[model samples]
Target chain A: MTNAIETTNLTRRYGKTTALANLNLSVAQGSIYGFIGPNGAGKTTTLRLLAGLLEPSSGEIRLLNQKLSGSGTEAQRLVGYMPDFFGVYDDLRVWEYLDFFARCYGLDHARRRTTVEQLLDLVDLTPRRNDFVQNLSRGMQQRLCLAHALVHDPPILLLDEPASGLDPRARVELRELLRTLREMGKTIVLSSHILSELAEICTEIGIIDCGQMIVSGSVDAVRQQLQGGSHLRIRILGAVEPAVEALQNTPAASRLPAIAEVRVDSSDERVLHVELANATEETQAALLTHLVTSGILVSEYHAQTENLENLFLRLTEVMS
Target chain B: MKNVQFISLQPNPIIIKELRIRMRGIRPYAILTIFLIALVAAGYGMYHLMLRQALFGGSMLSFQVGQGLFSGLALCEICLIVFLAPAMTSGAISSEREQLTYEMLLATPLRPASILWGKLVAALSYIFLLIFAAVPVFSVVLMFGGIAPWDLLKVFLLLLITAITCGTIGLFCSSLLRRTSQATVISYSAILVLIGSTMMAGSLWSYFSGPIWQPVPPELLYLNPFSALISIVTVTPATSTDFFFGGDVFGLPLLSQFAAGVVHYGPNGPVVLPIYRATIVFYLILTVALYWISTHLVLPRRRWIPRWSDVTFAVLLAVLIGGTWLTHDWWRVLPPPSI
Candidate 1:
């Protein structure tokens, strides 16, 4: 698939401090690409560079295959940017705020009116269209800012920490809205310091630390690449001691592979935590059968789930 | 494609937004009302003073009273413009930065020049309103028959131009400074230097020259709007013929013998370029230059290297100022065909 956004050796420096190092990034069209990083890891800097609000100390950026150059108006027209921290104009109504931006993009009177109405409806702010912008709640103002970014109808969005200050309900609503946008074929790239925030919604995730991309790909693919082996949690019907002994006593010369390790759960002694050298459906079935046939009743056996939080912590730990 | 190109030429969106914000509040109305009241009060006081003088000495004539009223009103308006014009615009760009709206505005496709122009027009339009609002009080001078309609037009035009120049000065400072308070302080200081220092320097220069007949170079007072307004109020057809012949220093009759000359040695011998015309030309140039610099300062990623158009603009400005200086009398208004 073609990339909606691409950066080659994008670096930004303020004096001797480098905000973003030489980095290459590619975001596929119509996908939600999450940029995961710690604070001051150049997430905001990267988004600002891509939005053409800051000049890269060195390197290039292209949006939708067009080189971002000069004043970047052409490339800027294809991308809408929502900053992490933004202020609403005082005394301006919601619709007027949207209308002002629409006019800035040079939309005509007739088109501006329709566009404002559509954006108000899309952000679920139609009820508050006449209300002053400063009077809106935090979540409502965020939605209004999002609507402002969409006024030009850009095909791509660069949102910086979009869910940072939102409450749980607002975050969920924002996720649903993003999914809707993706369905409408708009590529989105958003940044966050929290992994779980983006893990569920992101089609692809890029882990960045210290101004570098550590890993990036489909969720499962990244997990598999980072995790070399699998862990399993097996609960025996009776005491877990006999099951542990049998799992460990399997002959090294036998056709069945030896289990890597076995240990009882610290909280529940009935359950055993097993580590496998390599896991597959057949091997797991073979292991389950061996336990049951040996008069060791196995109540439950399944591979343990590894959340993105653990993966993020481990990845950053390795780098540091 | 053609439609898109045309849309780019439309009026800037900032002007519309700014004007809406400015006109919606009651503050603008209150300020305008106070401005008119002050002018009317000053006009009433001047009229009574002239009446009392006439009754006591029986020397002050009706036309003299009219001239006195016109002078008093013109100076009051000048003082108001000097104090208020910069205040109105010094916060234009800096306040946006303070409010955190500057970045969003910059992110749009709007050009920096468009933003600066929009701010200038919006701020100066209100000042223009204030100037126009006092038109009735100024017209009262005509009732007594000393000030001409043409002279009133000249005074209003001077006020408008002065407001534009001062507005640009404030905008330039606002673009340079990050805080509105700093911008305002710097803007007022710059204006004070322009008005106060130049007059002091001119007076000192005339005092040191040591000869009553030596002409005070007109260049020193070109940036002083007050001097320009004073010259306009004092110079009349009856006095201008003597003015050219070095009869009296228009308004400063007591020091006329000491500062009797502003003669420029042109090809046609001594050419007298009116201070008002010189000031107008000088301020017009200043306004354009400041506007250009302010636009560049506001640009998100300004090119430090000068472009071809920039170089050409610089050349044109140099030529315009240089040419105007060399042929100082070209702008001289010929005395209205001797009745």
Candidate 2:
């Protein structure tokens, strides 16, 4: 698959302070790429560079296979950019606002009407088309901004902190809208401090800190790269103290260092948790068998996997 | 051809959007009503004042009344336009940035020049609407007799040009300043300097230069639209023709030398001073150049002129030099010998 967006040594500097440092990023076509960072972490700067709003101090950006530098209007046509905060004219009706942007994208009269109506329908804002923009709620305004971004139907969309002020229901709506856009084969590169939001929607993730990309890859790949091993939860029905004691004395636990530590659950007294170190499924099975054979009352055992949140926390913690 | 076709196809969305928003509110209507009432009240007061003065009898009194009414209303209109233009235009671009819509507008395929033109045209159109509404009030002067239809037309044309020039200055200030308040202040201050200082400078030069040479130097008067308006309204062909360049310079007759206010060439022909003409043309060129530079300032990377804006600028300078050469008669220290 061809890359939808690519950058080479994209560095943006503000005098002595480096906003984005020697960053190279690749977002595959049709993939939902989430840019993760803390406040003042150059996420907005990177998106602005991609949107062609800010010229790179020294670098190149390619969107939809077109070189962005000095390409003029041709490169801008291929990407739709929405900044973190944008204002709407209060006097203009919602349809007029979309119509104005659609016209700016060079849509003709007939096409502007049709496109505006279709977008309103897509964002579920058709009822408010005749209503003034100022009268709409914040969530509606955000949806309107999203609809504004989609006016030209560009191949790539760069959104900055899109779900920042949205309520949970609105966030869910925005998430669903993004999913629908992904289904239509639009490459989305969005930056957000809300890791949970990104984790729920992003197929690919790039974590940046102090102006450098710390880690970037597929969501599962990044998680696996940070995860040490698997975790096991063992629930004992009666006399949990004996089960814990027996597990510590088991020969399999001593024979294989993969069974690193076993501790009782702090919240639940009846449950015991086991941490593995570089352990495979076979070793896990052997440990389980030895535990049963040792005459310990182990009622149930299950493996719990490490998620993207754990990976994010571990990587960010290491950098900090 | 392709560029022209592309430009022709792209309707200026900014103009349509701005006009819709401006006209949708009750503010413009209120402004129009107040503006017309003021003009009518001023015109009526002048006519009533002239009626009480019985120094002239019959037709002479009527003509004086007409002239007084027309002159007062025209000057009032000019002052209103000069003040109203900056209010309409100084916020054109800065307001967008203040409202946070500038970035989104820039992100689209719209060029900075298009945005500037759209803003200027929108601002001027509102002012023009006000000017148009006052036309009937000015027409009441026609019922008495001193002013001709052509004179009213000249006044209206000069007002339009002045408004456009002032609007451009406001836009340039708006583009340079980040805050709307700052832009408005700078725009009004620049207009005041352009209007007030030029008149004051001309008067001072006239007082110091002695009475033999035309006081209120025509050259200096050419720089101020208000002075140009006064010269155009009062000077007649016979009074002004024989005074300069044998009533013709560069083989073009002076507009002031014609009773009908038309330029005619020859020794006996009307010698129009063309002070207003020079002012309009000079201001138009200045406005265009200023607007071009402001567009570049807004989008420094994607300039209207690709790489040759500097070259284009050099050419503009050359044109200014050439124009000065053509108008050598007007700027001379000594008055031209009469025929």
Candidate 3:
């Protein structure tokens, strides 16, 4: 399948500083790709380049396989971009602002009106249609910007820091709107520092640091890459010292077959949590058998489900 | 054929958008108000001065409400035009940079020319509106004097030139500077240099020519658009003369009144000259050139962005200024000693 965005050796510099350095990126069609980075990581620069806001110093970009160039107006016709911070002539009413964009996108009169109304409803701005943009809350303004971006109904959307500065509820709403857009088969490329937001919505995530991509893959793939060892936690009803003693004495817990390594997190009066390395089903059976044989009770056992925060920390820390 | 016919810019939607933005702000209006009050006051003062002369003095009383007779008021109009031009155009690109609207605009299929063209014309039109607002005062000048309709037309045309040229310079600077204030200052400075630099150079050259080569080329003076305009209007009279209305509006100024102005002022008083078409041509072409450069520099395909070029030009200009000062022998040199 053709990619939605493809670049080859893209580079940009500002005087002595290089903003993007020989970077190559590809965003598959019909996928929500989250671009995560700290400030000055060139995420915004990449978005701007993709949106054709800045010319590349050297190299090339393709949106849907068409070469990006000055005459690629048709390519731009199929793309929608929401900048990191955009101006809304604060005095313009909501519908008026949306309608202005619709007109700019060259929509017909009836279609433009219909499209604007539909977008307003989609972004839930219809109730405040007559209010000026400045009067809207930060979240509402963000939704309005999203609605404006989608006014053209393009196939590709490049949103730069859309959820930045939004309240928790507003961020949730933006996430939901993005989720809906993803369901509609739009190719989305969005950048944000909020790892969880990305983890919740992104099908694919790429972590960039200092203008270079350090890691790119699915959530589980990234998780497994960061997983140093398998960790198993157990809560017990009986004394933890005896249970630990029993497990230490029994081959099933410490020297169980099919186990490569083991680690202890904590030993409390009632429980023991441990980390294991490549512990298999046979190793678990042996450990449980030894526990039963020793007459030590096991309350609960489950694998730790790693959150994206750990994965992001692991990846960024690797680069640093 | 398909490309040519598709997506026609029927309404030029930007002009209205820009006009709204330019007019909505209180600060812009406040700036314009100051100029407006000044024009009205000066215009009224001129009318009253003429009225008194016609009423009490035995003079060749000629009366009519004109835009303004004195160069001082005209200079103020020029200052107002040039000052407001930067405000309109300096915000053109910098505000977009601030709001990331430039990204939004770039995402559209609109050609770069279309975008810049929209902005330039918008800035120019705002300045034009300010000039238009003061037209009533100028119109009053015609009621009591032998006012030449063509002369008023020329003045309006000059105002258009002043605004467009200065406004384009401001827009060009805005494209170059990320900070709007810096863009405004630089743009004004550049415009001042463009307008006054030539006059300064021409004056120095005339000083050096010292009657030996004074008439070598009268056309050299025309290199400055301001000088070219004033020269054309001031030197010719046949085209601008109101031969039929040459007499005062009250006709012959009641013969007894003529003695006051006549005896007091001599035949040496400045005569009103005929309007010149050449002035219009010079200003219109120069305005067009400035506009062309403003748009051309903004082409997306141009690898050169506005800021770098402007900075480079600024450095070069400083070097030239330093070199000129160091090399020019403005002071007389002593004759070489024994060499």
Candidate 4:
């Protein structure tokens, strides 16, 4: 599949400090790409660069396969960007705000009217259409800003910390909205310091720290690339001690190259935890068969999926 | 296709948006009402005072009373325009940055020039409305007959030019500075210096050069907007009159030195005083140059000196030098160089 966004050795410097250094990023079309990083990890700088609000000090950027030029209006037309620190014009009514942006995008009057109506509905701000922007709640304003970014119907979206100040419900709404947009074939590059924020919706993820991207790829691919290994949780039907003993002597647990270590979960006596140096479905199945055959109370058998937060920490730590 | 072209030809969105907001508010209308009412009361009050003097002196010329009223009103409007232009414009771009909306604007398809002109025109349009509202009051000069229609037109043009220059300087500050309050302070400070320094320097130069043959120190007064207004009005009656007051005229009175001298001519024969023309052109070119700089600065992403902007600057400098050469004869007639 063609990439929707690509940057090669993109570097942005402020005086002697480099905000983003030799960053190479590739986002596939229609995928929700999550950019995770700590505070001042160059997430906002990268988003700003992609938005064309800041020119890179060096390197190349291609959005939707078109090389960026001076001013980047051509690339800007293809991307909708929502900055981390953004404010609406409090003096303008909700519809007027959207209408102004639509006009800037050169939408005709009739189209603007319809687009504003549809966008308000999409963002669920139809009731606040005539109200001044300042009258909206923080969450409502965030949604309105999201609607404003979508005014031109750009194919690629660059959102920096969109859920930063949002309440849990508002964050969920934003996630749902983004998911809908992704389903509609829009390539989304979302950046957030919150790891859980990117966990559910992102098809691919990148962890950046100290102006460098530590790891980036599909969620599973990144985890596997780091090879931080897998964690399996097995709960016995009766006593955890017998299951733990059986797991120690099992061929799949001892001889299998994938299984690195096996031990009982200390907090819960009935649960046995196994750490695999390398895990594959075949190895997991083999272990499960051996546990049953060895006469361990095969009540629960599961392979835990590595979460983005853990992988992010591992990658950022390794980079540091 | 026609409809699309027409839409594209419409005014900048920033202008439209600002105008719509300003027009909907009570502040602009209230300010307009108060401005006009004050102008009327002040003009009539001056007329009443002039009328009493005329009656007591036994030479009650209606033209004299009208001139007094027009001068009072014109001076008041000039002060108001100077004050209000910066007030309207000093926050034009800075406040957007403060409000955190500047980034969104910078990312849009709108050109930087469009945004700069939009803010300026929006502010000036309000000032124009205030000016137009007083047209009936200014027309009072017509009843008594010392002021010609052209004179009123010149006053209006002066007000506009002053507003444009001051407003552009304010915008330039707004673009360069981060905070609205900071921009406003700098803008007002710049305006005060522009208006005050010229006259102050002229007085000083006149006093210091008293030993030698000193003209009316056109070097210092050339950029003074207040002085420009006076010269425009003073030269109206005798189109061929010398607006530059020559001879050693010192102090504030030197501002009106246009009174006694016969007109002088350059190689091209007699023309309007070059200082007056230079003041107008100076402000006009300065306004345009400041506006271009403001637009350049307001871009969220600006290179220190892009090759294109460098070339544009070169071309502009070339044009300025070439134009100076073309108008060499006209400039030679401006008062002799002084400190």
DockQ of each: 0.39, 0.40, 0.41, 0.38
Candidate 4 docking class = acceptable
The lDDT values for all models are 0.80, 0.77, 0.67, 0.77
DockQ value for model 3: 0.41
Docking class of 2: acceptable
Per-prediction RMSD in angstroms? 5.2, 6.3, 9.2, 5.1
Q: What is the full ranking by DockQ, best candidate first?
A: 3, 2, 1, 4
Report the alpha-carbon TM-score of model 3 versus the true structure.
0.78
Interface RMSD of 2: 5.5
Across A1-320, the per-residue lDDT of candidate 3 in tens digits comes to 99988889898888788888887888899999999888899999888788777777888999989889854465567678898887777867899888777767777677778888889999999999989899999999999988888877888898999999999999999999998898887899999988898999998888888888777778667666667555566676766667667655545336564333333444454556665565656676667777767777777866675777777777778788
After superposition, the stretches of candidate 1 with alpha carbons farther than 4 Å from their true spots are A250-261, B1-6, B55-58, B202-217, B235-273, B308-312, B315-319, B330-339
True contacts kept of each: 0.47, 0.62, 0.42, 0.53
In candidate 4, list every pair of residues with a backbone clash: none
In candidate 3, residue B328 scores what lDDT?
Answer: 40
| Model 3 ranges with Cα > 4 A deviation | A8-26, A55-60, A70-75, A245-269, A279-294, B1-6, B25-40, B51-58, B63-79, B133-136, B194-282, B299-301, B304-339
User: Candidate 1 residues B1-339, lDDT tens each?
Assistant: 112222565578999888888887699899899989999998898778667756665355577667777877888898889998899899999998888788788777877767888888999999999999999989998998777899899999899999999999999999999999999999999999997787776667756876642445666777888767766665332243332221332212322232222333333343434678877888888987887678678877744556555675687778878877786775443321111
**How high is the lDDT of residue B185 in model 2?**
98
Please identify model 2 stretches exceeding 4 Å from their true place.
A246-257, A303-314, B1-8, B55-60, B202-214, B235-274, B300-321, B328-339
- lDDT per residue for candidate 2 within B209-236, as digits (tens), equals 6553333445565657776675455433
Report the CAPRI category for model 3: acceptable
Candidate 3 per-residue lDDT, tens place, B1-339, comes to: 001112755555466567666677597789678878988786566556555655664243343333224222444466687677877888787777776667677677665556767888888876787788877756665664445667567667777776776777788788777778898889878877765666565545535775532321323333344443443223222122233122312222221121111111113432331212333344445555555565555555553445444564456555645554564443112211110
Cα lDDT tens digits for candidate 1, A209-291: 88888888988888877876778899888777789888988756655545788999999999999888877767877888878
